[model samples]
Target: METSHPGTGDLATRATEILRELTGRSDAAFRDGQFEAIEALVKDRKRVLVVQRTGWGKSAVYFVAARLIREGFGGGAGPTLIISPLLALMRDQVAAAERAGVHAATINSANATEWDEVLGALRDGNLDVLLISPERLTNPRFSEQVLHPLLTGGVGMIVVDEAHCISDWGHDFRPDYRRIGALLASLSGDLPVLATTATANSRVVDDVAAQLGSDTTVIRGPLSRDSLRLGVAPTSSPGHRIGWLVQHLGDFSGSGIIYCLTVSAAEDTTRALKDAGWDVAAYTGRTDAEDRARLEQALKDNALKALVATSALGMGFDKPDLGFVVHLGAPSSAVAYYQQVGRAGRATDSADVLLLPGTEDAEIWEYFATASMPEEADARAVLAALADSPAPLSVPALEPLVGIKRTKLTLLLKTLQVDGAVDRAGTGFVATGAGWAYDAARYAAVAEAREREAAAMLEYEAGHVCRMRFLAEALDDPTAHDCGRCDVCAGQWWDSSVDAAAESGARKILSGIGVPVEPRGQWPGGMEKVGVALKGKIPAGERVEEGRVIARFTDLGAGQTLRGFLAESAEDAPVPKNIADWCITVLSEWDWVERPTVVVGMPSATRPVTTADLASGLARVGRMVDAGNLQLTRDPGSPEVNSAFRVKNLDGAFRATAETAAAVDGQVVLLVDTEIGSRWAMTVAGRALRLAGARAVLPFALALRG
Candidate 1:
């Protein structure tokens, strides 16, 4: 039987003091569920799971519990350990810990130079709280040398923030979290644990609860925000959404976030909003770490009107006064949407939350949904490769043999390790020979769950239900009720019109073409170890020139149009006229140091017309000679893999005829493709032409895909 604390009045009074100190409010007191969570951890010393909305004092519970446990106020001792996914934002948490008079330290990538110092502090008992990231759990040395000691006795309580990740993305890309979930379940009962999240639905909640332990205490509350006024604006196209933002941004009271589904959409929105004279910045995965920190501070300072961002800015970014949140495209699940919009209306009396639904959202959703989950064949191939290897093989070395991309291969290996099929050996992996079975039934169930969540999102958009109530119900919130503040109940509060001039300008910005394709400066690492006969930098004399493409495949204007023609289901037809025209337009604007005098088409088994038309048309318009084709010796493999695999996949895949070589000799040659994905295809083709005596190679394509 689980031990229950007999008295809570003393613990609650002491907890109130810590809470007031943490929040800097003399009158501050625990919310309805906060005191209970703290008392359970501090007095009862049992596992506690708190499912509450953001800004409901989840962090306060752990911070106060750490204090009480350290002070022996609840018959407990030792430091508190927090595993947060928001590694980059750990600094803010550390600062928050200080305000409560608790000494906190963290060992994360952002503070790599201070790891030794932080670890020392932990061992010396000078630190009251230690924050860690889930990704760090993958490091073998840290787990063995550092984490092992702390879990043995140094940690009094453990807090898992954004705990839904334990059962959600953990199953897909983050195997470390899944493994940690198992580790947490095996913890000694006397060592208290707290798991908290604002986004978990009933399904995710149950999954997390099962991992925590059977006797875990669950404290759940209302997911709806009374201060939020939810609404959805009808916008058919990307331009219309951008135009709507440019026209109506002044209606909001203060700085906020504008969420985009993709990096390109964020950048496109940033440019459109900036062009229309709004103070904004783009935040995406590509944003530098330092720049992300700066942008977060700027947003908090209200120095900028908004930060147009992807999911990179999603969780753990706290700004209580955030005025509004507008989505350019809907997320795949209502739970995800609810978590994102929860960022707003936290401390404000009223905050605007709107969704501008796009026609392409479902397509983007399908693309991501497929990419996030690994196929069984890929997993089996990974295991087979590990079993075949005489020694441990790194992800890059394993990429070519297994034909799986490096990122996905790394994720798969971690999962295999967690599941007992493989073991981490230094930077590489070795087969454990434990004989793992593929959980096909579990994967199928997860797929079905995702589909149901996606369908619920569709219902949330147009089912005529109250928006807040729909989201709350989708999250399975027991306290959910119809909020009369939503657009469905109170009538639409935002205007749906876009300025015609602004719409045309946004279209122009979206349609603008000619994205520069930077040449690869060096060969990828671990190529020789994988048996690919290539190494070092491409000789300057044989390198391809800086290339150009009509647009990025993720761009809004020509990019979306390009997707329709290049989609998997679209046939191998002649190049679309609009695409050909865009190509000509991009070429006309090219200010090449030395213009090409000949064009060479790359052989394409799937897109012969597209390849030939682009090549012949460029030669025809530029008055350059057509140098025929670069023959395909074999399939070059998928261009979506990592650099090493991609580079090895294209080795000896292309060849040039002596006659075509003669035509290209001593002439600047224009290399053309329907799409310039990976750029390795062009790199290999260009090197072959250069080795055959072409003066220089310049690549041109309809779209650039990274």
Candidate 2:
């Protein structure tokens, strides 16, 4: 191959032409640092790091650079390999590529059927850009069959989007992004690389840059967005937050997003808004791909007022004129808050951005913050189990043995895999037999860093300082200054008081009962490995009828009272009069096909008085047979264990005595518990009761947790 690089002026002219094509605007020109990033990759053949605020045309830099490289302006004739983190991002980039007249395709989990066609396009030299997800980098099949040839043979340029995710200090816990560093290191030589992010602080940027390359060119800009008017709406409760939205969402100009910390919150918010005659949909990680596409299109088309969503809606969906962003609860960190709210006011002059902080935010923050980092003891336990196993063990099989929940275990395994302590063989994990020492100091430092971040977030919500400047300085923006548009910099702009009618409606919605308790249809796999003989589907004769919950532990209604009674610090006592009334109401209003003729309490190792009182009260009030406590024949052990382990722990813990069996013989049984965490106890206890001759069993609880 011969070098025939285009002149700087020619490169800029061609890049501008592609930019106009991509933006669909004849006058579209490069924003500050955009063309420089493009030229650094195509002309200087240097690795570039772009740290700009949202909507600064970061995508244009890579797309233009890809076009230039493909046109042979930089002595390259290979397609660009963009390692994007999210599927929504890939969809957006591909669409933008087509508009720029670049033949772009993607290979990701969502497009498995189109992979062969996409690979054919790559092989035939007909593709200009090929986007892949970070997940693919760890796939053994994809690594050997696809990535190996691409990285070794040729690539015009490698683009790492949302590059902050690669940093150990800054992730919503994207363990897969660690694999990108390995991919960057394995490149043959001298390949142009680019990394881009909108919400990285200086520390995160440095961390990502160090992993990217020692010579990486960091082009950072001011983080403040002129179009965003940030504010904090202080509300005492979740109901007040919902009421605020129900009353004031129409005050905004156009469609936008309402961000929630969890899927349940998102769904609840969506239902509240819709019930108040607002056109909104709940979008979460649980949303199906097809529905997400549809809901995204609706919001883009401005057919709906808003999408109540979790973080799954961030990082990828682009709507140029999104009107507003409201947080139903405070985000765990400032970076995440900025990234999500940045989606608004991109192509518009101004957009409203508000945060409604909840008292529970700190608890939620602690949960998500510690979810990714592995503890030394847990790591040792997992490694020992894998090493001692005769064969590779799946997560389900390992869950009971290690005593870590599935979600935490999955994340730990990924971190371990990236640390060279484990490898995937088929559907299970195996020890890599490598010398892997747990870095306790590193984990501790990370925790301290998070604590500082959390403190900063609480400060942001307090609103004593300028909101925009606080966010900008948090990102280490050197040019951070007070924006005259924020609630602090300027005077308050929103109506902070909640409407009486809307507040009442919100209270009604919150107090509404009946969260269904889904019965465990199948016993967890590999239960026999833990000495529990359960396997396959639970027999219909042993399974409990679909159960009911008065409220979730995290709910804001009767749940507040329920959470108080059952809190770890609360003394063991019978349910309060108000909470008991709520429970009895739930039972009386239950829509079951058959009413229970007998009541039995699931024996509680801790809260025996509370559990027994509830069962006896319900039986006495409803005039049903009282069967007393299901005898605790064996200890149930710690409730922190995962499904298979928990089931094994509860296998013989409860015994349905002959007298208890006769009490409910051929009669429906209402099984009561103070709270349900794993639900394995409920399942096993109900099975015993059924085996002892109850015709049907229905489990009821004061609260449910996911």
C-alpha RMSD by candidate, in order: 9.4, 9.4
Candidate 1, superposed: residue stretches over 4 Å from native: 1-10, 168-174, 388-400, 405-410, 423-430, 515-706
Instruction: Give the true-structure RMSD of model 1.
Output: 9.4
Candidate with top TM-score is 2
TM-scores of all models? Answer: 0.74, 0.75
- Compute the lDDT for candidate 1: 0.82
lDDT of 1 by residue, 1-706 (tens): 0222325547777778878999999999788998889888888888889999988878888888988887776676678889988744576788889998889988765455467778888888888898998866776788887788988875788888888888863212256687677778567877799998988878778888888888889999988998999998774899888988999998888999999999878877897898789999888865544457778999999999999998888778889999999999999888899888999989999999999989899998887776556688998888888889999887757877887654467667767777878887765788888988888887687777778878988888894988988988978888788789988999989888788998998887777787666565566645775578777778887799989888876676688788768765568777778888888888888878898999999898778988898788889888999988899888887553556667777888888888898999898999988887667788888999999898899988888663
- Can you write out model 2's per-residue Cα lDDT over 1-706, one digit (the tens) per residue? 1224565448888888889999899998888899989888898888899999878888888888888888887787688999887777887888999998888998876555467788888887788898998877777888888888887678889999999889878845488898888878877446899999998988898988888888899999988888999999774687889998999998888999999998778867886898799999888875645457778999999999999999989997899899999999988789889999999998999999989998788988998888878888999999999999999998867977887866789989988988889988877899989999988898898899889889989989888889998988888999988889999999889988788899888877666876666576777655666677888889999999989878876666566667667765568898778877887888888889999999999888679889989999889988999998799987887664456667778888889787898897899999999887767789999999998998999999888754
lDDT of candidates 1 onward, in order = 0.82, 0.84
